[model samples]
Structures are given as C-alpha cells and as structure tokens.
Target: MPDVMPLVTAVDQLADRLRSLPQSRLRQGAAAHGLDLARELSARAQRLEFPDREPRSVPDEGLFVVADQVAVTGRDLAEAMRTASAHEVAEAVKLVEEAARRCEGTG
Candidate 1:
C-alpha cells in the first residue's frame, strides 16, 4: 500500500482550518470552497471505489457541515486509494494540496 500520510495531513489541515473559520468568513466564501473541495474529493473516492458506476454528488448540507464533510470525504478518498497505483496516489495528493492552497479563505 502507498503511504497516505501526506494526504491525511493535507486534508486534516484543511478541515481544521475550515472548522476554525468564523461564521462570517464561512459565509463570505470559505464554506463554498470547502464544499466544492469536499464534493470533488467525494467524487474521486466514489470513482476509485466503484469505477463502473456514475459517482453521486455530495449534497450541499449547509455551511456548518462543510468542514466535517471535507474531512470525511478526504478520509474516504485516502481509503479508496490504498490499493491504487502510485500515479493515482500522486494525483490525489496533488488534488488535496491544490485544494488546501485554494482554501486559504477558510484559514
């Protein structure tokens, strides 16, 4: 299995940042970005775990749940990628890293 600590770290960091954001900030754009990232990550995991089926969309459950959604989805992706190729793992890492950078608003 590939080392997934990097993905874990990146996603954890993003989730913590999102959780710490003030409600005002979350309302501004943080939650939106977090939700987007969560949705994308969820899709990636679904594809990894079930490539034959169309991935379902992660619902917009509201701003408050964004952080948890992101965290859970990230973990799900990490789990699904455990049996994946190195290139696939690297792609996931890159995705999380980019999302982290873009989620600066949540920090």
Candidate 2:
C-alpha cells in the first residue's frame, strides 16, 4: 500500500505492449462478435422504431451479417474462456511467487 507505483507502471507497460500487437491479431474474433452483437441489438432497436416508420429490409440484411459475426465471436470467446481459467491459475501462482520474493527481500 505504501507504494503502488511499480504495479501501476507494470500495468501501463503491459497495456502499451498489448496495444502494439497487430490489429489483425487483435480483431481476430472481433468482426464476428461485433456483427453478432450489433445484429442482436439492431433487431431489438428496430422493434422500437416508430410504428409509422417505413420498413427497411436493407437494415435487416445488415443485421443478418452482424448475427453471423456474433456467432463466430461467441465460438471464439467460448474457446478462449475455457482455456483462460488455466492461464489465470498460472498467473495467480506467478503473482504469489513474486510477492513472496518481494516480502522476503524486504524482511
């Protein structure tokens, strides 16, 4: 608690490093998920359109594309989530080890 600067700096560096990753790699699952989420949201939004508003099939078609994307993203996310727990456990162990080292050094 006395000094959080190192943690903040570490987090910032990690974020910057992540930001430097290739866009294609970053968006690997995004297009699909974005399209899906957008489609679902659009469908819900369309239903809220004014009763007298002119019908638009074009929007519906666009939403279909989005829905497809969402499906792809969902699949990717599910796989990632499944593997993520293991990674989380490893990271937690690493953090504990690092903290123990620091405590020993200080003591």
Candidate 3:
C-alpha cells in the first residue's frame, strides 16, 4: 500500500501556498476553504479505525474531495495571480494541481 503521508503533506504545502497569496476576497475564501479541507483530510488519515489489519487504500470519496478542493483552490489562486500578473505564482498553482492529481492517483 502506498503511504498516504505524501498526500497529506502535499495538501499542507498547497494550503501554505494559498495562504501566502495577497489578501483579497477570493484569495481569503479559497485559502480558508482549502485549509479546512486539508485539515479534514489530515484528521481522517490520522484516525483510521482498522484495528488489526493494515489498510490497503485511501477512501475513494476522500481522494475525490481532495482533488476537487485542490482544483478549486488552484483556480482561485490562478485568478488572484492573474490580477497581479504573477506568472510564477500561476505556475506554482499548476504544480499544486499536479500534486493533487498525483494524490488522487489520477496523474
């Protein structure tokens, strides 16, 4: 089974990136939303209930939600970067999307 820690770490890194964006209604909203999703995912990962056996996979629904949130947050970040002509930030957002896809095993 693949480790889920990488996915959680990626989500945390994306959230940090989002939080560093310039303050604006869109940025604030997206960052908050993404962070909340990341937090929930992290919590779920930490609280797996299987007692005697190692889990074989992450929940598909949880992966889907993470992917969706990452896409939305990336879009929001791209839009924020566009307003400031921050091409580097836009690229970084793309990377975040890629990481999210990888996490979902869809990359």
The candidate with the higher lDDT, 1 or 3, is 1
lDDT of 3: 0.42
| Number of clashes found in candidate 3 | 0
lDDT of 3 by residue, 1-105 (tens): 323333335545665554444445223244444544444433333334333554333233332244455544444333333333344444454555564443334
lDDT of model 3 at position 40 = 42
* Candidate 2 structure quality by residue, lDDT tens digits, 4-58: 2333343233233334434553345423333334343333223334335643322
* Decoy 3 TM-score against native: 0.33
Give the Å error, residue 20, model 3: 1.8
TM-score of 2: 0.26
Q: Best lDDT goes to which candidate?
A: 1
Task: Tell me the tens digit of each residue's lDDT in model 1 across 3-107.
Answer: 887888888998998898889888888888889989999999999889999999989999899999999999999999899887887878788778777777344
What TM-score would every model get versus the actual structure?
0.91, 0.26, 0.33
Quality of model 2 by C-alpha lDDT: 0.35
RMSD of 1: 1.6
Candidates 2 and 3: which is better by TM-score?
3
RMSD of each: 1.6, 17.7, 14.9
Go through the candidates in order and give each one's C-alpha lDDT: 0.87, 0.35, 0.42
Clashing pairs in 1: none
